[model samples]
Target: MIETRILTADDWRTWRELRLAALTEAPDAFGARLADWQGDGDREERWRARLAIPGSHNITAVLDGRPAGMVSGVPGPRGDTAELISLWVGPEARGRGVGDHLIQEVERWALRCGVGVLRLAVAPGNTHAGALYRRHGFAATDEPGDEMASGEREIIMVKYLTAEDRTARDVTAGDLSGGCAPPADSAGCAPRADPVPGG
Candidate 1:
């Protein structure tokens, strides 16, 4: 059976291991390089700091007692939006609905937090990953975001979810408008890893 759970500050060891694995296996998927974080005495500190974010939640998936995937979400500056950051699924677990499962958990977490919108960034050339997002209710936005350090152009996608008038399919992956980072006075989605992370 596959299992998934939200991460807390105490999950630092697992977080550090999985994050490093993600960076090592899919270097281009993240803005931060594995080398940048590896071997640092403060890596543990970084993991704790990230977990300490009050508005953030991290989900980790396990299959047969091994880590399979992870996804993180943090509240948008607007308080009504949530951004999915740093998603990654291990190679052996790709086709088992792990990605969908991870996203669903984020949705549940977002709804409870009163998030009205959900957003993520996709690297320009990954068609398969883009299709997956579209299937789940994410649509492309022409949002202007800084080019990732990997030289990949990013396309922002959004889903809108509200407590009322939400549909089964719609609620699965829902709402967004024109992208281009929220306005000067607005809070935009935070830096996310790759579009699919490593999907």
Candidate 2:
């Protein structure tokens, strides 16, 4: 069973755990490095501040009682947009619907915040991640996105929330009451994807 929990600064420890695992397992997927959050840099206050980003929603997916994935949504500089960030799924939970659930949660939140567009950035050469975003209605744009530490530009994808999309979401709002449910088999779920470090 997979479940998602809305996280606050108080749940920084859980966020920290999943974050470290993400950076360690997929160093190429994010702009930030594991060392950036390790050693003396791994302080309690730092993790707390990360989760406390103003106007941001942080979520962690729990699979059978263990932390499985993490993602965040922060209102963009423009009032009408929100950017998805920090998306990662543990190997044990990959292809189990955790990634889809995390993304959907952010989409629902963006709708509530009245944002017309939801955006995200992907590392270049990450074809699987791009496909996953495309499946969720995000399209790559020619616009430049955040620059990574490696001097590469991230791929920007946007999903414009139309009136029809809003109405469909409204009709299914009740489905948000429970945790995300994975298919009976791994093959039934789409492969999970990674996002740029901060978006």
Candidate 3:
């Protein structure tokens, strides 16, 4: 079974491990280069600062108590929308529904934050990841993402959530992390933070 949990400030160690692994293994998958975070004297302190930012939510997925994957979503310009990012599944755990569970959990968090629209950026050549996003109801939009160091560009995809969809998930605002909490007025509330720290 896949188990998902929000990453609190104390979980920085685990976050760093998985994140570095992702960056090393899939250098082309994210905006930040491995060099950007390779050897930082204040990495831990930086991570703590990241966690304290309100509306920033990072999550990890585990299988049998071992970290398997991660994904995150944070409120967008309007609280009714969010940008999903930092999706990564370890090599050993791919194709085992790890990604699915992560996406589901992020979606749940988004909904509780009053997010009705979810968006993501995926590189065109990354077919597997694109397929996964499509399976979860994402579709391409005209928006363009900045050029990557790898020279590949990003394509935007979006998904819309409806009232009926919110009803399907039994999550309430009270049970959510303060980091993932919706604004005082969730509707059209400005985005205060990102799901991932740097990107």
Candidate 4:
């Protein structure tokens, strides 16, 4: 069974290891590279700060007591928005619903924290991830991401966590996929927040 829970201090090592793996394996998918994070003088402090943000949440998928996948989100500058980040699944864990569960867990955390919108970015070459996000109701935004290491573009996507489009509803993990419309690859979609923090 895969268990999902909030990341704790003790999980820092696992978090760091999985993050390094993601950065190394899927360089284009994430904004930060291993070189940008490695050998930082205050690596521990940075990890603590990341784990300490009030609106930030990390969920890890543990199978047989080992971490297999993880996802995290932090509040955006806007009060009702959050940015999904550091999403990844181990090589052995892919195609087993781990990615979906991680995303669903992030959605639940966003709703529980009163965030009405969730934003993310995907490398244009990462069709699998793009399709997964689309299947879960995320719509592409008009904004484009920064140039990736692989020279391909990235696309921004967002999901609104409200009912009736006027009133804020208590969103749950299951609500993310409820009544979501397919996204068109046109330029008229709504604008989305920057996916990378310093981008």
Candidate 5:
């Protein structure tokens, strides 16, 4: 079974461990390099600050009994939107529905925040990640995203949130089976102080 746990600054240690693993395993998938988070940069305060990104929501997925995936939703560049960031699924959980669960959790959080759009930037050439986002209703936009350290522009994708979308999500939110498990993709945020009640 796949279960998700909403994390907070207090869970920095857990977040730190999974984040380092993601950066190391999928070095090309994230904007932040693993080396950036190591050495002196690997301070406890830094990890705490990341998890405490003002109005951000952090989630880690547990497949059966092990941590298998992580994702974050933070207030976007625009107030009406939220950004999904730092998405990663462990190798052991790739064929499972962990990625879907993580994305759905963030979508629920965005709906509760009343955000009109959810945005994300997938690294160029990460086709699996791009297709995964597409399946979840995100589409590429002409708008440019942040330039990576390598000076390449990431592919920006956005999913517009509407009343109808919310209604449909509400109906299926409780169905944890998430249908067939899509191949987990490492792609890669929103919300209020208490965005998601009851975690």
Candidate 6:
């Protein structure tokens, strides 16, 4: 089973490991690189500060008591807006429902915090992630911004948390539109797809 929990300082080591893994494994998907983090004296401090910030929610997915994935979001410039960031799932956990679970957790957290909008930036070449966001009802927006990595363009996607989404007491990942289909060998979960633009 997959479970989601808020990240804390106690999980600093796990967070660091996963962060470095993301940077190293998918440099073009994120702004920071492992070279940029290597030898940084304040790395731990930076992580601490990030977790300590107000209006920020960092979550990790645990599969069988081990960290399988992570996702994070923080308040945006506008009220009722939150920016999704640093989403990743370990290789061993891919093709499962971990990614969807993480996203649902983020949505649940955002709704509980009274945030109405959730936005995320995807690297133009990341068609897989773009598809996932599009399935979640996140429409591409014209908001231009710096690319997460050099030489790559960023596409902004937004998901509006309507009143129904907030009031629906037991909303699960299936209720949303965009997310990777679960693996065929897994439980008898039906797989579906929606064509996403620019993917």
Comparing 5 and 6 by TM-score, which wins?
5
Give each model's clash number: 8, 0, 0, 0, 6, 3
User: Residue 187 in candidate 2 has what lDDT?
Assistant: 24
The deviation in Å at residue 38 for candidate 3 is 1.3
Off by over 4 Å in 4: 164-199
Q: How far is candidate 1 from the true structure (C-alpha RMSD, Å)?
A: 7.6
TM-score of each prediction:
0.79, 0.84, 0.88, 0.78, 0.84, 0.81
Q: Please give the range of 10 consecutive residues that has the lowest summed lDDT in model 4.
A: 179-188
Residue pairs with backbone overlap in model 6: 135-177, 135-178, 136-178
Q: What local lDDT score does residue 191 receive in model 3, on the 0 to 100 scale?
A: 76
Which pairs, if any, clash in model 4? Answer: none
Per residue, candidate 1 scores C-alpha lDDT tens digits across 139-199 of 8887875477767777889988855623332432323111212223222334333232222
lDDT of candidate 4 over 22-84, digit per residue (tens)? 877887777777787688622876665555455456678887788998787776767567778
lDDT at 119, model 1: 88
TM-score comparison, 1 vs 3, better candidate: 3
* TM-score (C-alpha) between model 5 and the true structure: 0.84
Strongest candidate by TM-score: 3
Clashes of 3: 0
Q: Clashes in model 2: which pairs? A: none
Native-to-model Cα distance after best TM-score fit, residue 102 in candidate 4, in Å? 0.6
Write down the worst ten-residue block by lDDT for model 5.
Answer: 179-188
Q: Measured by TM-score, how close is model 1 to the native structure?
A: 0.79
- Model 1 bad stretches (over 4 Å): 162-199
lDDT for residue 95 in candidate 1, whole number 0-100: 89
Predict model 4's lDDT versus the native: 0.69
The C-alpha lDDT values of all candidates are: 0.69, 0.77, 0.76, 0.69, 0.76, 0.68
